[model samples]
Target: MTYLKSAYKNAGIHHKMILLIIVLMLVNFAVFAVILKYIFHIYDNQMYKKTSEVLNISSIGIENELRNIEKTTFKVTTDEQLQRYLLQLESETSPYTKMVLRKKITNRLIAFAGSETYVYSMVVIDKEGQVMSAGNREGIPQELHSTLSELADEYDGSNAWYAAGHSSLVAARQFKSFTDSNFTLNGLGTLAIRVRIDRIVADRVQTSGRDGQLTITDGKRMIYPETPLLSESDMQAELARKQPYGIATYSGGTFFAAQVKSSYTGWTYLHMTSFDDMFRHITIIKEIVSTIFVIMLLIALALGTRLSGSITKPIVQLIQNMRKIEKGDLDRLEEEALGPVPFSTQDEVGLLHRTYKKMIRRIRELINENVAKQLLLRETELKALQAQINPHFLYNTLESVNWLAKANKQDRISEMVEALAFLLRSAVSFEEQLIPLRKELDIVRSYVTIQKTRFDERLIFQLDVPEELMDAQIPKLTLQPLVENAIHYALEPQIEPCRISIVARVREGSLFLRVEDDGPGIAEGFLEKLHSGQVTTRGQGIGLANIQERLHLIFGAPWGMELHSESGTGTSIHVCIPYVKGDQGHVQGAVG
Candidate 1:
């Protein structure tokens, strides 16, 4: 009975709590609905309309280019030079005379077709299946004879037509001979021009406006300016459908995409504008709304707290206890009991108080369970580390000696051995402490020198270290791991010679060390995973992960690794550590 009363009193619910929650929820819902309808919906609709306009413009441009090619083919076929070539071939009978005629015709056709920018290739074939003239014989397909025969019948052996293929657009025209004085027409030969479709699409795609695509298709096959967004089968399936459809989806927090079919070509053109690019204003609005919501929430909490205190004393005490629990205190409730009340209450305040007690108990149990598990995990990790030191220590010692012997520098070798000894001593003696930037760079240089001997001519190293930043404090062995990572991941895979650059500079009292490589860059999606501290299937190479962990532990969130890369370019790892000069140590790089 005392427990029930105590729980009721400490629940911290009042009439004002009910009223405030109801009002805020209603306000939030109404605002969200109104904004969604007026702002987001209308904006998306406008985007769809704009996308359709762009598709229409692109369709018109493509149609115009196709028409231009057809017009050019018509003009070339009717030219006086082409007629003369055909007449010369028809009049000849001897093999030498025919060969001479064929050469003349070939030269004339080449001169006429080569003058145009878009004409990929031209070929002239006689009615007797003899090749008379040709420019770029590679363009002439094996199936040309059949195609020309059909074309010859359609246009009375003088008409022009376009053929669509996998990688080329063929424009063929048949020429005739006027031999007799009666002006009778005789089939002479065919002229065919092939144009690269990819190049043509590329040129048109470039001129298309934002989010616009130029699509070329003839009933079955389609060519899109953009690479296939949908699978080939999916595209074909979508194209097969007769009715026009449009849909908008939120992809990566931005709305982008509109598809339209060309009535003439039966090709669908899809225009995609990044929502992030288009509706920046919405993000701004969301930020403003979020800021306003936070401000209002704070104000509401303050008012609710003050108002509820007067009406409910026991409830206020319960809230204070809950705050203690929030601060990780799960001992016991400090407040006393209030009067008896049923668990089922019509009032909102009573319901809230009942729910609060149940939640507090559950949270306390979870914390206790989590703490025990964490302690066990930490113990297991410590045991694992203790078991794996001898092998690592021996390996590092051997590597130091090898580096010394290869360099042939006794003095530097002695210094490096001493440094390695000191590092080992520090590791065994002192747990871990921040060290000078000079010490870190020394370790990094030694590591690089060791790797350099292995790679020899294939690896080149450059360093740009400012004198002023040498003494800046940093986590021990901080720079070494990053440099090692640059070598292992960036340079090791390359067959060609690679360059590794290390730059250390001071920026506004903060020391920055950048390790860079001119090898195949880090794989795409690596940066996001590294930044988020997400465990990936491909392990973060050796020292890279260790360096990041140490930075985070010593300098919190801001002073850690920043990675940048592009495929085929290379990768860069930037380490930011706070600078401290003389006795005046600034606590600017405190860990979170």
Candidate 2:
């Protein structure tokens, strides 16, 4: 096993692929051969079975017609008028009465003959040798009388068919008086119904071979196929053997034959065929298929070298390049290391090389980019540290100014400076804690005092907040931004003083703070953008939207801000928050 493996490993890829193709071809042909043989046998068996079935069906149909003929003969004999006329014509010597009786019998024969398409001729021969006939009068010859009378001789009130000359199917039935008490042989007559055998088997034959023959035989003579495929002696020999049905010999092996017995008539149906002629196209098809297989195999061999080299050479180069990298020889990538070569076809190997080249280029770009990203990261860290120092410095300066104002005894300046210091302190600690509403109001008042110093009498504000909500806690700076906005947009740009009302109301276990300004109302477009948070205003330190988001973040999302304004009227901003005071979650649920 080791030696075989070594030899296979040493073999060229071209030889390996050719070997694989040869193995596949052999397996495919082996399976096709078995299926082909099976299909051939099935074709022959089905053809013979189909031929026998068709012939059997035709024979039954012909027997049914003959039975109808016999039944019609019995019906004619029972017609009392026709029977009386026949008997009267035989004995009456009056010429006028004889003419009338003959016309009546002829009319009766016409009725039976016209009833069925199978009836070629209907003839009735009385015991007195008088004859009456209807339908296809030209069909019966003068010699048909003697020939058909012999068939009627042995009949015991049933039908007997004969292979009459001129391809006639003759059924003879003996008619006797059903009502006469003295019914004897002399009183009986023959009713002969002649039909064309060619018409009986007209559309019945189904055979693939053009010269194939299907015939009905009465164990005495062939009854169909006016031109028989077998000679008279050969047909006689085949019939005499009485092989109920199945394979019979024909001209050498070129012809095939099978027989089936009719259930309606005790007749044998024979089918003869030339199988070689029928299956000659199959041989031609086999030859064509063999030619195509050989041609494809030759083409495969011709293209084997190029196809195998195209697949294996690129993969082998990629593997060698990988091995060099694995051994840490990546720095020695030079002319000695194989480069990618263009393929003559778009195959998997070509795709692999294309991807490998792209990967090598992308990896080099990524390494260079990663180094630049690390340097930018250090620069960003320095900027972040510088950003932290400025806020601390501003807070320190505010404290120093507050202390200096107090020591100098500038009472009003000291008050303003201390409020500034307290607001700055709250702002610094705002993110870390929640404050009481009173602390928020102090910040708003201090900010309002500072704003009033700039716009003396133009901003008149009132606080109508209830004492119950004064202790309720909320996010710091929630209401201050809204009040600052009312002072800025509503009072800052007006000559007349505008009144600002701050009211706190509790309803449905929730606290609602309303800030109203009776100044020129917000513009229609700006109000829409403000409500939708599409515009921002820095009236105080943050816009109304910022306080809204803060209230939502501190409480749940359901607590937020609401705004209502008219064009010429005033504006109102409502702050809706969960009512939480010192130790209470909500007003009614307050624990303290």
Candidate 3:
């Protein structure tokens, strides 16, 4: 309740109605008995800590399938071609070379007993005892020549589990020939394998249901999964109650068990359960929170004694309509909070005076839709700056025909109409969208003086540019559409003459410039339609994708343009800006 209105808004109204009726009846009986005692301590200590995290996640998936059957019994017992065909089939007195060294060691134990599924069989015995089995040798039942002398007198070549009298379990390993430790001959004979331990702990005791009772052991015996609640005196009173690794609570506490152990078959695992069928949902959430905490404590002491005299008159008219909504007059909260909330009853101070007049009509429709979306985004950015005004009236009629060709003295028609009126006043400039690399090299020297009076002497232009980068800052006509996409793709067609350079450097911290052009270049089907922008028509006035979209709309997304072409070795292009100068940094948004 807004923390009981900021802990009884400066207590006085009969000590804030008896501290809101003794803090809403002791915060509803101490948060309903601390949420039913934290859901009975998460269902009796998280159901034996989720059965020791499902027996340590089923002993990490049966120790990754018993370390892939101990890496397929150490790759068929360190196979030097199955140990030189089991040391030449132990001196083959030739029964057809001992049946071709037992068909090449049974085709390499048919790839570790045809790859896993709990690898039921894969034997390979040797040192003169010739045995070469593969998978499901009927999941190994008995006589491997009377347990090869009880597995070479209990040889510890590792993986030694043993059992296999039908209910499987035999992991065995015994292959000796460490290639001549004096032929270490007595036993290159047992790789038994079998493996079933109820199919390797059957899906982790099927997730601890049936009130548990899984078992494993290996601290000297009990491996097969014999049940009847682990018999022999309930497996010595459920592995003698008190846990060693994880869960515990014994029969006296109505059971819980858990355990785990494993570290690759040192086997312990345990499991158990019961505690009234594992917390029967914390005893059905303590009988639905003791019947909703005794029917919300008799409906909060019968609406706190019929809300003690109009609950301090709607919290003193909601503190004088929240001091007239904290003084920022919410448009006269529908005429001063509707004459002190005429919300004729229906609780919580009439839903706080109809949610304070629906929050002052959603704050006057979000302040008239944010002042009509900021005056329609400033009338769509001044109608896109009035479409760059009519190209400044064609640069004021090419500055009155370059002052009537310099009052008729006609010095080359007034320097080609003053370089076509400085390329029509920097192409109708919309307030220096970044300029000065000396007015973008005076609009690329008046667009190479009107493309050198129409390619006279087959056009040749070079600019090496660096009078301290003629006052750096770029993106105006970013080097006149890369010198008009290098005179419309390296000098129009190609009757030879086309050298156009334009350079400018400053490597790492950006600001490159390039442009180069020995002509006949960009053709591989229009340089893959100008690097896939699918370049539409216009070639010179503005095309290399409109000066690489005005160098990513005036130097923003890491500035732009980068076309280094090469057909007959020509087109260069570069551009890439971001050196920044004038108003030292802060553009980051002009993608148009």
RMSD, one per candidate, in order: 43.4, 17.5, 36.7
Give TM-scores for every candidate, taking all chains together and pairing residue i with residue i: 0.43, 0.44, 0.27
lDDT of 3 by residue, 245-292 (tens): 333444345556666677666777676666677678767877887777
Q: Candidate 3, clashing residue pairs?
A: 490-519
Question: What is the Å distance of residue 204 in model 2 from its true position?
Answer: 5.8
Model 1's lDDT to the true fold? 0.64
**Which window of ten consecutive residues has the lowest lDDT sum in model 2?**
583-592
Model 1, residue 534: what's the lDDT? Answer: 62
Prediction 2 global C-alpha lDDT: 0.73
Q: Which residue pairs clash in candidate 2?
A: none
C-alpha positional error of residue 322 in candidate 1 after TM-score superposition, expressed in Å: 26
Candidate 2 regions with alpha-carbon error over 4 angstroms? 1-27, 43-51, 89-100, 180-186, 203-212, 234-249, 273-284, 300-592
lDDT of 2 at 118: 73
C-alpha displacement of 314 in model 2, angstroms? 20
Runs off by more than 4 Å, candidate 3:
1-24, 31-35, 49-89, 100-119, 125-131, 134-170, 175-185, 203-259, 263-298, 305-307, 310-592
User: Could you tell me the C-alpha RMSD of candidate 1 in Å?
Assistant: 43.4
